[model samples]
Target: MIRDLEDEILGCTRCSRLIDYIRKVAIEKKPKYRNYQYWGKPLPGFGDPNAWLLIVGLAPAAHGGNRTGRVFTGDMSGERVYRALYEIGLSSSPKSESRYDLVELKGVYLTNAVKCAPPKNKPNKEEIGSCSYFLKKEIESLPKLKVILTLGRIAFDTTTNILGIDGKFSHMAIYSTNRLTVVASYHPSQQNFVSGRLTWGNWISIFYKIKTLYTSHNA
Candidate 1:
């Protein structure tokens, strides 16, 4: 099933123009984006198959997941996020290198809204909307998705909207509607790290809430 999904994603041309633009920028303007690799390849999902928890992020980081081909791997954002997951016992392994690395997510599945790496780490609204079908299909494939942890406001809003939920954003608030429990948190971006907005303790708190929600729902 996952393989089929990946194939479909690879063959997708919904936003071909946007992808072309990204590829051009990555290849032609390589000198400008020193932090990221401009390999111009599609992104892939990582994590457990029968995962009950789904994590949604904005898009692949240029030097991070985009280069590594696995979601949230080889990036600063991933480092902090994965570490928090490990500390909270959500992740099976502490380190997340490649998909075949010594990393495991027992009941967690990770994916991004956009599969391709966008320019300057920002995907336009049209591109995001075009990629919504894949996200919807990914959610549909997860039969045990009881909790969804959205890493940022954009991911939170996009995932919830895709799930057909209506509500405003409130930090640390759990939204439920028989389908799944939605939890929101600030994205573990460089800005958050530099400004000390998302500290280790704060990230752990968010993960604890997700674990608690999952436990309570299953109980």
Candidate 2:
């Protein structure tokens, strides 16, 4: 299943023009960056085949997921996320370095709204719209997806739009739509880290809510 998804993504030129432009700029700006080599390749999705929990993150970090082709890998955001997953009994391993390390997810699947790395880590609306098809397909492919943990406003908005939900952002009001529990949280970007906006305890609190919500949904 994963192999097929990768093949489809690699052959996809639906957004080729935009991808090409982004690649050109990334390469020209950071020639030494390894992400430039695989910048054009389709990003990979990870986790259980029947995952009930789906994590929607922003586009892959230029040097992190974009370079490794695995969501949340080789990045600080991933480090904190995986640690929490491990603590919450959602991951088999604490380390999410790469697929080669046998890192596996349990009952949770991870993906991004935009598969490709956007310039400056921000994907414009046009680019997000262009990649919506893939996101739609992924959501459809998962037969047991019941919860979505959106890691920022962009991710929250995009995932909600894809799921056909209509509402404004409310961190306090955890809503249920399309048979999914939508949990919103701030993106664990470097900016959040340096500014001390998302501390370790606060991050864990979000995941704790996810655990409780998911458990309630299943019950």
The TM-scores of all predictions, comma-separated, are 0.89, 0.88
Off by over 4 Å in 1: 21-39
Tens-place lDDT digits, model 2, residues 66-127: 66667888789988888889999988878787646778888888988888777677788888
Off by over 4 Å in 2: 1-3, 21-40, 170-173
TM match of model 1 to true structure? 0.89
Q: What is the lDDT of candidate 2?
A: 0.77
Per-structure clash totals for the candidates: 0, 0
Candidate number with greatest lDDT:
1
Q: List the residue pairs that clash in candidate 2.
A: none
> How does each model score on lDDT?
0.78, 0.77
